[model samples]
Target: MTRIFSALVIGLIFGAGIALSGMANPAKVLNFFDVAGSWDPSLAFVMGGALVVTAIGYTFVLKRKAPVFDRLFHLPTRRDIDRPLLAGSAVFGIGWGITGFCPGGAIPALGLGYSDAWVFVGSMVAGIALARLARHTMAARAAGKAV
Candidate 1:
């Protein structure tokens, strides 16, 4: 119950930050992407602010032996830059360029009840499902060959 409450509070704070920073506005994001048109560079400052805060938070977290809630930090052990990572990143970039809505911004934009936001969210979900299915099929094929 405490963990759930903490998570809810964190999510609310994050959403409020996104909203207050104007990141929830699709037009702002689209304008940022439109370097050839009336481009807006405000998002760059928002991203930089986020990066600085994240860096400070991570620095403090790493200094602790254990997290306040979790038993361990459970950080990713894999550091290799492989094919799947590259392919996925490329696909994500293409989608972002076409839609101007990354998953985080998409959800908030959808909350504003825009038809385009709904369409983007639907396509984003479909892409995620397709990626998961492809990964599952590849794993199954690998297992079958090993048997």
Candidate 2:
């Protein structure tokens, strides 16, 4: 219950930050990507500020024995740069560049009632579903081969 409450509070804070920072605007995001044209550096500042805050927070938080909400930190252990990672990254970049909306931005942008945001979010869900299906299919094939 405590963990759930904490997560809810944290998520709300994050959403509020996104909304306040003007990151929910697709035009701002698109402008950031327009390097050859009028490239907006505002997103870079926001990202830098976020990175700095995260760095400072992580530095302090990691000094503790364990996370407040979890028994373990649950950090990712994989360090290898593999094909799926590369492919997924490329797809994500392409989608973001074209639509000016990543999943994080798009989800909040829906509050503004933009058609592009709606379409982006819908497509994002479909992509996630397809990825899950592909994973399941691959696992089944692997299991069959092992038998």
Overall lDDT per candidate, in order of appearance: 0.84, 0.88
Stretches off by above 4 angstroms in model 2 are: 145-147
Q: Per-residue lDDT of 83-114 in model 1, one digit per residue for the tens?
A: 99999899888877777778877776766666
Residue-level lDDT tens digits of model 2 in 23-137: 8888899899999998999999989999999999999999989998779798899999999999999999999888889887887788867789998888899999999988888
Q: Return the top candidate by TM-score.
A: 2
> Candidate 1 — number of clashing residue pairs?
0
Q: Worst 10-residue stretch by lDDT in candidate 2?
A: 138-147
Error of 2 at 75 (Å): 0.3
Candidate 1, residue 22: Cα displacement in angstroms equals 1.8
